[model samples]
Target chain A: MKEENVIEAEELTKAFGDFKAVNAISFEVKKGEIFGFLGANGAGKTTAIKMLIGISKPSSGQATVAGFDVYTQRESIKKNIGYMSQKFALYDDLTVKENITFFGGIYGLSRAKIKEKREQLISELGLEDISNKLVGSLPLGWKQKLSFSVSLLHDPKIVFLDEPTGGVDPITRRQFWEMIYKAADRGTTIFVTTHYMDEAEYCDRVSIMVEGKIEALDTPKKLKEQFKVDSMNDVFLKLARE
Target chain B: MSITLNHISKSYKKLKAVQDISFNVEPGELFGLIGPDGAGKTTIFRIITTLLIPDAGTASVAGFDVIKDYQAIRNTVGYMPGRFSLYQDLTVEENLTFFATIFGTTIAENYDLIEDIYVQIEPFKDRRAGKLSGGMKQKLALCCALIHKPKVLFLDEPTSGVDPVSRKEFWEMLKRLQQKGITILVSTPYMDEAALCDRIALIQDGKILEIDAPEAIVNKFPKKIYNVGADNMYKLIRTLQGYEHLYSVFPFGEFVHYTDKRDSFEAADLKSYLKNAGLTDISIEATQPNIEDAFMELAK
Candidate 1:
């Protein structure tokens, strides 16, 4: 059986005047796979992600995400994907349940469905007692979990998470990965970006972006073996220094 | 001791920000306070630098009492906070000169101290600090912090949002600074960075869990850990979590970190069990514990 490619990009190029933020990159993401996009601070990882998510048009390239054309069918692409950016995009002043309800409404979920999901999310995170508490009062870990759950409210075909576990504790980070695993098990594709090399190991496969080009892409083990590095951090250092 | 703390505790209203934590740093040593956000690492830094008054206990930097000799301590220590605090609208050169002037020193007077880092950002001297990239901003802030050449330096979460290459460069700069005989106390949420420190104190919830060299800390994890993987990682984690003898099962990078409560355990037994459970491509191997594994054990 052949695996489906949920995302496909060929010769993807995004240029800002003479500077190429993303230069002729090409890759495919298998359906239900967790694909890691790794890079340094200004390495154009964000630019590539924006193009795939249909927010930013590529200067020259051809791509399809969830079977929708990136150049023309962006509105359809937007409907089939969920995104959790680095900044927690939740309303801090709103109560937990209210925030969930508001986001669910934006996704056009039914009123009854939103109510059910709100309860399920609150209980799943062990927040049953404080469902009415303002999101600002919750701990950082709890807020992060809530933000992730809300991103999944509409159950889009794919989820794009940008540094979802930054500044979180080990325990919380561990638990967050567990959630990601469960979601993947249920057949949702995950596309994530992170600075933590350790987290890179969790992905099914990872691609290293250096200075707007794909430097390496393979299973973590293969990349480590090919680079002859013990860890992903060392592999990253070796490539990024070039 | 370059830095000392005795039963330091701080509370904001009812929440205990720091709880009776104590540690010491030797002169010219590179020490790390490793933990996540809200772990009370910053509170300790602020307390030692004489920026905040602890509700109880005493601290000193460079032999000066934190409470009584705050002015002297301030003159002898440099602090780079987690967030960038430079004048964003000003040019890089202007910001550097302003910070140097306030510290009663000129950039030319301390040229040697910041020469390595300043040279990297010198081309952008005329660019506004706000317009600089993340790595460039970090370098500028570091240079300004060292302009006066303080004996001890405190950096809070310096590499949190930085990229791999820049992070490597920053650590290299820290090594050069340490070689110059300046005591450094750095706090980071990254466990791998702990190995670069001479010694580290693992902090959580405003308390020190353990303090030792990075290798020593990893050696302290008593349980045997195995790196386990299968064709279906999601199913692998779920199945392993249900295993009766498991002590902990969490997803690591490529493998699931598995530990059993019972000391009497064998890989063959678990391997056959997974095979029977309809899992293929199983790879299980005993692995040495790392600082993060040790931290999870200590934090428990």
Candidate 2:
């Protein structure tokens, strides 16, 4: 009973002139799984992510994201996936309701459904009182949660989060993971990149990249066992040092 | 003491960025200010570096008053801000040289102070600072901060976005710098990094929640914690949230951290409860508290 892979990459490579930013990396992400992509700064994590998300073309090899070809069929792939970057992409000047409506509009949701979802999202995040307030006036934690909620407005098959919890506090990070768990429970595949090693342990499986290549990939437990370390941070340190 | 603060406070209109807070950093010790964004870590750093004036109280660096001896404090301390501040268009070597020249020193004179770090970036000397990788930029910023050979250093979230490996290397560099008797004050939101500091002040909402050695802080967590996991994690959390004896249930990595309101609660009781609730693959084990656990307890 093998589950279908939501993402499949075979020797995916991306080169910038003489520099091969993502070189010959291959991995598979199962449907409804939280896959953590980790690497040191400049280790090609972003380059690889860009290729999969259809923003950048691979120089060689092949990849299929949400069952759509990376080289072609990019538009279909884009529609089936959601993305949230380190920077919260909500319009600051717009109110919370306005930001939700704007993103829902871009995703082409029906006006009626968008109205329903906007109410649901605002209530779920306990932003009811601040629904009419400008987004810039909200706190960092609230803004991040709002950004995450907006990314899923279209109910995409997969979500890509790049360092989504970089500067947040531990308490907020805990709450954010709860959101991730809820999304995963709903059968949406999560493809995320983060610097927090502890967050790696939260993933169903993690792949470590270094020097434009996949250095290691496995469940956090197995990776820790293979590296003979007690924590994922130690496992990463050992691999990155190599 | 290399750094000292006596009831320092700073405010922006109605928002108190830093409320009456006081602490001391020993000479040559690595101290961490652990907090979240808008927690006033940067405000405190700015005041100590003499960049922003504190609204009340006083601070000193290297025995010089932050207000009276701003010039001496600036000369004797190194500060690396959260944002990358080097000339983006300048090459790595050019940026380092410019910083050295401004400090009335040459690379040749301060070569030993930055040798270990500089060597790592030397190969990329011709690359523009902005073009360098995050790790390389961090190293370059550190090198520039050290070019003057200051006795004290203040780093505000230096490894905020850096990878774990580069973070380890940066901390190793800090250790080497400490060996040279330079006091360091660093702020980060990462809880794991708190363990690397000799002592840390857990701050939030412009107040110090706790301050002590990392181990001591973890040791101070009030209750026994159990790691609980089952097939349905979200359900497990919801069920535990409704449990009568549960104090708190928060997700930690792969497991939900559970603490009981009753001190005498046992793991078997939790295991049986989960099993009765139709949770398969249920596992419950007692676990020691970490910095985050301590922080959560203190924050409550």
Candidate 3:
């Protein structure tokens, strides 16, 4: 069981002055699972993520990512994970192909490998016509989809998406999720956070954080059943409002 | 009508931010400009608020011409931009007071108007605007926008990144304000929030796809939707995308909202196809279409 778990955290905590942003949360994520990490705006989701991805040191606890200890192997953990935020994605001035090449270079891909992946990615996303267009000029949805694919240029063990579909259309949001489904199918773990509850229902397992602690973590079905609700929205409200 | 646009259009060089768009927002009604980013929702809001002139067409707010009476329109509209525009250095109370004083009003004058929302953040009045949480900043922004007591309120993507709990609270505040006869022209990308509006204009690519009451919009969806699920979502989507009779295959929560090109669709055919694809735990049920379903169909 331990070997099968890609991420395992026990009593992981982060504190600032007297406040514990992440209150000794414990969880394990299996390989190839779509795990939804959800919370209110200041519920410490970002704090926990920072710790899990090995950017921040834990106040006290034990954690491992892709089988590397967080405190001692921060660089190793970073190498095994891919992170993308909604606010900052690809370079705006760079063209679509340039952004891919730049990120691929950052990920340490060989020139030949980058060229090969560029062709596959461009064709897969149907970006042949706009391959030379600046990424900033692409439509909002297209930019987001392209950003997600670029994040996977390194093919890390797990991809962390922070509110990946913030302000896109209904179809575009679903389309981004389809990309997630495809990646998960390819045996890469997807650890994502989103505000949209409908997206939560798509997660294999969801963990909702309140204030500084995870109030509930389970399959969306069981969480709804336990909260006496039919939807993830109600379950979140029940937890956050408490 | 409280607001009207007569074939309004705007362009930024070669880009058509808004096409020949025309719509009427009735008095005291909570009308929503429902669309995603770059759908020209902000452009429409700007034209009505008199911040920007339309390339072509005429629009009026509160019976005042947007071009001729731009000053009067400015006095009667409270605009909360999609981005948080309050002064980050100012404390919450100072920002509120500054907005009130500039508008020739005071927080005391409109205390009743914003008491419900203000009280939540009143405790954080001493904090700088930049120090507040995402939800708190939104509440403060709302309070500032409402301070002048404008006849028409325009909120642009008020809940873009706020969590679900805060989003619900914000909508409730809007409903309360509507009871006071303030016409709200709010824009959002969230399709679920569309159901809460009195009426919504489904805009995309700088064009209105549909305009009607929320239920009416959902009712207008032409296709019958079905919820199809199996052991594997990715495989399920792949299989459905390959189906010869597929019209649209979207991933809804726990199922793919499947539609068919043929009117007389058979679930048995889809189920057998999935079974043959080496998938199990399949479940298919007929479902009603919602605003999202309608938007996808129209935008398709």
Candidate 4:
């Protein structure tokens, strides 16, 4: 049986001036799979995510996400996807519930659904005590978790997390991964980018970009075995050194 | 030339950034202050570097009070902030010179301190700080921090935004810097980097979680670890969690690490149980824990 892919890219390219931020990259993410996009700084991970989320236009090639054309059906694609940037994108001054409602409203969610989701998210994330508190008042890890919960308020088909756990504690990162697993179990495709190699190992499949090119794409174990390394850091070291 | 932080705590309004944190860094020791973003690592760094006054504690760098002798502290210590706080319009060489002049010292007095890192970016010394890559910016920042020959250096997440290769190279530079008998206090969010430190303090929720040598920290994980592999990985994980003896079953690469509540369970028993539950290619092996594992255990 041919498996269904939630994300498909064909030679996707993005260029700024003379530099090709993303250079002719091709890949596919299967439905409900956690696909990790790994790369060093300036390796085109963010550019690829932008094009996939229909925010930035690709310089060349064709792509489709969630069965919608990236270039032509950007609005439709945006409706079917949620995105969390590396830089926290939530309103700092807004209360936790207010932020969720605001984002849910932008996604065109109804008042009843938004209310239901707000309660469910707040409870599930154990944020009931601070549900009325401003987002800026929360700790970094809590804010990060809140940001993630807010992203999925609309229940989009796919969620794009760009370094969502960048500076969070190990315990918080573990909890975030549990959240990701729960979402994946509910048939939500997760596409994430991170500089942390250990997080990359948790994904079903990871693609490593080097200098704007997709240098390696495989399961972390296969990549490790092929590179003859014990840890993802070693695997990255080998590829980066090459 | 030792660095000492005594009962250091800082607060902004009601929120406590650093809470009663205390530690001592021996001369030439690479002491790592590791934690999440807002765990007060930066606040502690600022206190020691004489940037922000601690609410209730005293810190001394090279025997100079961080509060009373701010100028002496400033002159003897180097600080590279978490963010690239250098002047954007200044060239690499200009930034170095500017810092040197601030400390009332010339670049020649400490040229050897940054000679290795400076050479890589010497050609780009004319390039504006904003024009350089993340790695080059890191190198330039380090060069500027070291231009005055500080007896102690404080780096706050100096490798946060740089590439993997650059992070490695930067740590290597730190290793060389330690050879010059400079006490270093470095903060990073990455746990792997903690292993590079001679000693580390794991901070969380404005509290010190633990502090010891990295190896000692890992050695404290009190659990029997096992790496479990199977065909139906997801289903197997859920099933393993349902088992009465399963303490923790986290995803570890292609395997689910299954640690039992009791150390008495045999691997053969686990294999048979998994086999009966329709798990194919089932594999189990006792595994070692790392700093991350140790942190999770403590947090739990």
Candidate 5:
């Protein structure tokens, strides 16, 4: 069964005053595929995600996520998609359980569902011992994983993660990707951004952004072959140089 | 100039940030301090640069005592802090000029040292340092540090939060600076970056784990390594972990990196083990260990 794409964008553009953060980028992510959005810092990856998730409006072009128009159906799109920002974004002063409950409530999950999801997320992330601990006290890896779990508490149709593994240990990053794979296996489209070239190889497909545009987009294997490079790192170096 | 740290330990209240760390950095060597966050890399850098004095132990840079000859040490070493501690309100050019003035030198005096990096960001020279991009901020901070032509350069995670391209560029710049025979001491959390150094000291939990060349560190892994892959990889890892001879099993991208408990166990045995476990399309191959692998083994 060839399911329809979970995300589609055409000539998407976003301008902040005179700067075009995301310029004329177009890509599609099929349902259940892990799509990697890659770029250098300040290379428009975050801006594109912001538009696709309906948090930032695109100045031009058309986009649809989870079958909802990004411009007209912002509410519907928000309800069906999850986003984890570059910054941890969770309230540091809140307890682990409180953060979970707060995010669940914001997503409009009922009180019963919030309680159920909170318990499940805590147990899955092995945060039970620290559930009562303040979020500030948790390690960076733990905070990242917990933030990811909370993002998926409502079982959105798709999830967007912006550099989710930045500054995390390789082992922790490995574990986090495992969670992403599990989610994708359950038919959730995964959209993620990362600076680690090796991590790009994990995606089913990846789009490399330079300046404000998508310079290259393909499966990691195809990109490596196209660039005639042995590793993703070499492929990135080749493309970034151009 | 060479650096020596003898029984260097620093503490704050009840917490020990660094504990009795002793090491020597030879002249013209690119020494890297590799570790996770809060691993005392920053504290050690501060102590060595004379910004913070250790409660005990002694440190000397270029034969000058770090505490007693603080001014001399500061003048002889260039430091790029972990947090990009520079004057954000000033423009890139202004920051460079101000730092050079503090050291009683002009940017023109050492223009050749940072010319390559400066030229790339010269167009944005008028932009405020705070408004510059992550990579640009890194370059500006570096130029400011090197303007004084210090004998030793210290970079504390200079590539953090930067794009991969910028990271490559920054390292290239460091290599050039090293070519001028400047002793370099850099700290990074990235194991991959550790490979670029002439020698590296792996730190964890505020303690030294291992200190050696990256290649030597990788060669020290005691177990036979293998990279295994197949469809249903998660199930494969679980099954491999159950095998009697498995030393460690961890996911490495699309494949699982594993080591055998017994030297007698061969690659064929691993393949057959997966085959017998009802796994299909399995491929197993012996693999070379990397710096991260060595660090993981040592961390355990």
Candidate 6:
């Protein structure tokens, strides 16, 4: 049985002047699948993510996110996907409850639904005591978790996380992964980029981009065996070293 | 120049950024302060660089007190903060020149010190610092920091989000600089990079957990860790966490690093526990703990 793909790309390319930041990359993310996008520091991950998220226009090629065309239906695509990044996720000045309600409103949720979600999120994340506190007052770990929960307030078909757990404590990082796992279990497609190679192992399949090209794409186990490496870190080291 | 911290402590209001943190770095040695963000790595860096004075205790960089001899210490050390502190509007060459000029030196005088790193970004010298890419900006930052060519270097999170390739190359450059008799104190959130340091201080929650060589740190891990794998990664973790004798269950690459609460733990017994949970394709093997495993255990 072929799994339904929520994300499809055919030679998606993005260029700047003479540099092809994302060069003709093509891949598909199956529904509910956790896809790991790996690359070097200067590799075209940010560019590729922009193209996939319907923000920046691709220089060439074709792609669709959640059944919406990248070229003509970017607005539709935006409405069907959730985005969260470590750099920017939630408003610092807003209280936790306010942030949730605000994001729910932005996602076009009704008042009743937003109220229900706000309560559920607060209790689920064990933030009852701090729900009324400003998001900026919370610890980095808590803010990160709150933002992740808020990103799903509208229940987008897919969630694109850009290094969501970077610099978080190890325990909290694991907790965040548990959240990702639960989300994937509920059939939410997760497309994530991370520098932590170990997190790359948790994905259903990972694609490593080098110099704006997808060099490898496979399950973590297969990639390890194919490269004769014990861990994803070594596989990355071998590929990225060159 | 050596670095010594004698019970150095600092706090920002209620947060104890660094509490009684003490460590020593030999001359020309590469030392790493490994921890997560908000773990007081930056505070410690700031204290050593003479940018922030300690609330209590004392710190000496290159035989000069951080407070009493701030100017002498500043002149004796090169510091690259975690954030991009260079003038964004200035061209790369102009930024480099500006840094050199402020230190009462010319780029030509210390061109040899930053030659290897500066050469990489030299092609983009004419471009504005803000317009450069992430990797290029890092190179330019290093160039500006090294223009003064001090005895000691303080680098904060030099390779936190940097990829494996650039991180490797950056460490290589650091190793070369260390060879030239410059003590280097660098911090990173990446645990793997800890292995590259001569010695490392594992820190968290404003305190030092352990301080030793990377290999030695791993050797001192009190518990034996197992690389446990199964068909479903999430279920495996959930089941393992539910085990009665669970000490720690961290999600490592492709496998979970499982430790038992009891010293007399058996793999067969755990395998049967997982099997009862309907977990198939179970593979359990004893593995040598790395710096990360050591860190998670230490911080836990």
- Expressed as tens digits, the lDDT of each residue in B68-118 for candidate 4 is 999888888888998899999999889988998988888889888899999
Best by lDDT: 3
Higher-DockQ candidate of 3 and 4: 3
- In model 4, what lDDT does residue A96 have? 93
Error at B176, model 2, angstroms: 1.4
Clashing pairs in 6: none
Query: For candidate 1, lDDT tens digit of each residue in A33-149?
Result: 999999988999999999999999999989999999999999988889988975856898999999999999999999999999999888898998999999987777788888988
Off by over 4 Å in 3: A1-3
On the 0 to 100 scale, the lDDT of residue B5 in model 2 is: 97
Q: Kindly report the docking quality category of candidate 1.
A: medium
- Weakest lDDT window of 10 consecutive positions for candidate 4 chain B: B249-258
For model 3, which pairs clash?
Answer: none
DockQ of the two-chain complex in candidate 5: 0.53
CAPRI category for model 5:
medium
Candidate 1 matches the true fold with a TM-score of 0.96
Expressed as tens digits, the lDDT of each residue in A57-86 for candidate 5 is 889999999999999999899999988865
DockQ of each: 0.75, 0.76, 0.87, 0.57, 0.53, 0.72
On residues A1-242, what C-alpha lDDT tens digit does candidate 3 reach at each position?
34478899999999999999999999999899999999999999999999989999999999999889989999998888888889878999999999999999988899999999999999999999999999988888999999999988889889999999998889889989999989998888999999899999999999998878888999998999999998999999998888
Cα lDDT for residue B145, candidate 4: 87
Alpha-carbon runs more than 4 Å astray in model 5: A16-19, B276-279
lDDT for model 2: 0.92
Two-chain DockQ for model 4: 0.57
Taking all chains together, each candidate's TM-score versus the true structure is 0.96, 0.97, 0.98, 0.95, 0.94, 0.96
Q: Rate the local accuracy (lDDT) of all candidates.
A: 0.91, 0.92, 0.93, 0.87, 0.87, 0.91
lDDT of 2 by residue, A98-216 (tens): 99999999999999999999999999999989999999877788888999999999998899999999888888888998899899989999999999888998899999999999999
* Cα lDDT of model 1 by residue, B1-300, tens digit: 999999999998878999998899999999999998889999998999899999999999999999999999988898999999999999999999998999999999989999999999999999999999989999999998899999999999999978778888899999999999899999999888999999999999899999999999998899999999898877898888778889998777778899998988889989988998899999999998899999999999
Indicate which candidate wins on TM-score: 3
Give Cα distance to truth, residue B47, candidate 4, Å: 0.8
In candidate 4, what are the lDDT values of residues A72-180, reduced to their tens digit? 9999999999888658678999999899999999999999999999999999988888889998888778888888888888888899998888888887876678788
Candidates in descending DockQ order: 3, 2, 1, 6, 4, 5
Error of 3 at B18 (Å): 0.7
